[model samples]
Target: MNLPQSPNNAPDADDDLEPVGPRPRPKGIYALPNAITLSALFASFYAIVMAMNGRFETACIAIFAAAVLDSLDGRVARMTNTQSAFGEQMDSLADMVSFGAAPALIVYQWALKDMGKLGWIPAFVYIAGAALRLARFNVNIGVVDKRYFQGLPSPAAAALVMGLIWVVDDAGIKGVGRVDWAAWSAFAVTLFAGLSMVTNAPFYSFKVFGGRRSVPFIVLVAIALGIAVVSLDPPRVLFALFCAYGLSGYVIYGIKKSRGKPVSVIATSTDEPDEEGLHR
Candidate 1:
């Protein structure tokens, strides 16, 4: 019996036909990073709702917790090699809500409300600055120096706002009582911090994950002890410390420029050679 001609040896009736158009991607979602991002978004939304209810202290804590969660999601993504364009964009959006809008609104409701229109203006300024900061950061990632940030980081900026409120609340607990002028001053402070987020001044970014260190173990222990002492009164200590750090960039930048040794601008090109001729 003659077997039918093999299909591979025979020309199909539609042999001249082009293959179908590229298939659409299957609809599925990544789990871990997306989950973390959603949690952060929830935290931001909770912060706004709590602030509206006049739960000012709880709102501040929620924002800080959200900030912590935001930091983790990226590192987790990188470690898991699950990075994606969708996740990156979602992260930035969550940050704007958590670190930008939430903190500003909380501060405004907690303290700056007394200043009326002027108070609201600073909150708006801060939110605008955070948006700009995040946009710039997303664009500059991997292009700029990883060791230092080009300007004040959005989380740090939010921290400054939260720290100030915490300090004020603590003082209120101590019977210092709220002052109208203090609220106005806080508005001014927040506005200045927001402006600084987009400035060119370099701030130490604490990117010490893989660097050599000469400090001895004892020195690190001492530093940890100092930090622990300060943390005992977190509201007072952290507020003052972050406020100083927030202002330090401008002060240090001005001093260096005046001395004719300008702070190094963030390196934008990655192909330049180092002293030993390896690519920077």
Candidate 2:
């Protein structure tokens, strides 16, 4: 005879179920973009090593390579729909190494070091500026204007400074003698690049050139010509181009101000640093 089942003695339907604990946290990361960022970081590290070896020319080239790879990673992530917060932060860190620390160190070693205390000061200033700029950009990415950067981008700033070094080195103008005006020029450019990163000047982003936007055939031709020019004299041509771009923000800002148009780079509804003055 079977015993009658009491409510307390009954087998529960949930007997086979495992007790639910806190869910295991996610540990996966997207690989492709991070790999690219890592490569860029290595390029920067290589630059530093080359600089240490007194291979200044090779160091400068490595920094440029890092810049190119840095530029590509983000676009690749976007195009592949692999965007992640991890990727973004990784990119920023890689950029700091490639564009911020590497350039400052290379320039200091190549030219500024000869100036003694004066040398390290400008290098420090540039490194600090790059740090602040990267921090600000990370915070402002969502709110800032898509078409303009709030200040000179750290990469472009690095390019300007490093490009000068590369050009001078290529020209065999070692900043070591009474004729080393090139060293003085490097000093000035380092200071300028450092200061520019923290300014309110709006630099065109060129983001519009990406995506599915169509361009005239002349644009392609212009791009081809640009590549050809860069190939002809990498150091001189690239430095000149970056130098012009570094100055362009000021010109654009001046034009907008004269026209009584808004000059703020941030597009948010909140008050930006130059917004009030722009309106006035």
Candidate 3:
């Protein structure tokens, strides 16, 4: 034991063993899904730009475009097996801008700006709700039911607000900024969409359709007809659709409560950082 170890026969030190904590993040992120996310980010920026230029309808369209791209990025990441912490974080940030900030700013510019200091109230509330919603989503993602969302998804919330803008603008209704009714209408929509994002009510996620599960043939046919109808009148059809969806979570909550079934999509605690409450 007192003899020096021969170079070739030396015992390895503890430091020579591999480190035991989480492995280092991969050298770089995958390009494809991040690219989609970046594109969504760009669309959100473009929406803000369009809003600034008074092209509110075009801005609404860009928000919808961003939502579609947002949906694609996650699915693409999953499909390609390229999911990463970086991608998740990036997607969350993009959603904050696209669904949260952009819609608030757009609606404010289109209608709320003229209401004096009160104009900023709804906008601030909306952005705050979106932030809270996204943060909770990150914390609860691992514990929530895959088939349902614990609250109204940010994308759908954006659609609800932007859909209103699109419909009003498409109707060629002018000078909404000067019209109290129009401004109040935007006020109501922004408030509803914003608050819905933070609620514990369950909203169907439609992820059930993503698997190898088979459905009735008529389901596909109905989807095709739905597409055709939307094509016939995008602004109205889309606005109406989102309005129904915007209320869907509360409807689901009511139904579940009536049946004495658990209404929350959260399977465990929803408290930040460490789920503890198993939200009701």
- Which of the numbered candidates is closest to the native, going by highest lDDT? 3
lDDT, residue 214, model 1: 71
Clashes of 1: 0
lDDT of 1 by residue, 1-280 (tens): 9878897878878867856889855544568988998998898789889878866667777777787888889878878878877888889998888888888888887777776686778889999999999898886786666766777988889889888777776665422115766676678778987998988787877666423547667878888897898869977787787888898888878887889874655454435443122111
- Poorest 10 consecutive residues by lDDT, candidate 3: 269-278
Q: Residue 208 CA error for candidate 1 (Å)?
A: 2.0
Better of 1 and 3 by lDDT: 3
In order, the Cα lDDT scores of the candidates are 0.78, 0.86, 0.89
Count of backbone clashes for each model? 0, 0, 1
Residue 222 displacement (Å), model 3: 1.7
In the range 9-112, model 3's lDDT, one tens digit per residue, is 77677667978899875756999999999999999999999999999889999999999999899889888889998898999999999999999999998999
Q: Which ten residues in a row have the lowest lDDT in candidate 2?
A: 271-280
Worst 10 residues of 1 by lDDT: 271-280
Positional deviation of residue 160's Cα in model 2 after best superposition, in angstroms: 0.5
Q: Candidate 2, residue 92: CA error in Å?
A: 0.9
Give Cα distance to truth, residue 240, candidate 1, Å: 1.9
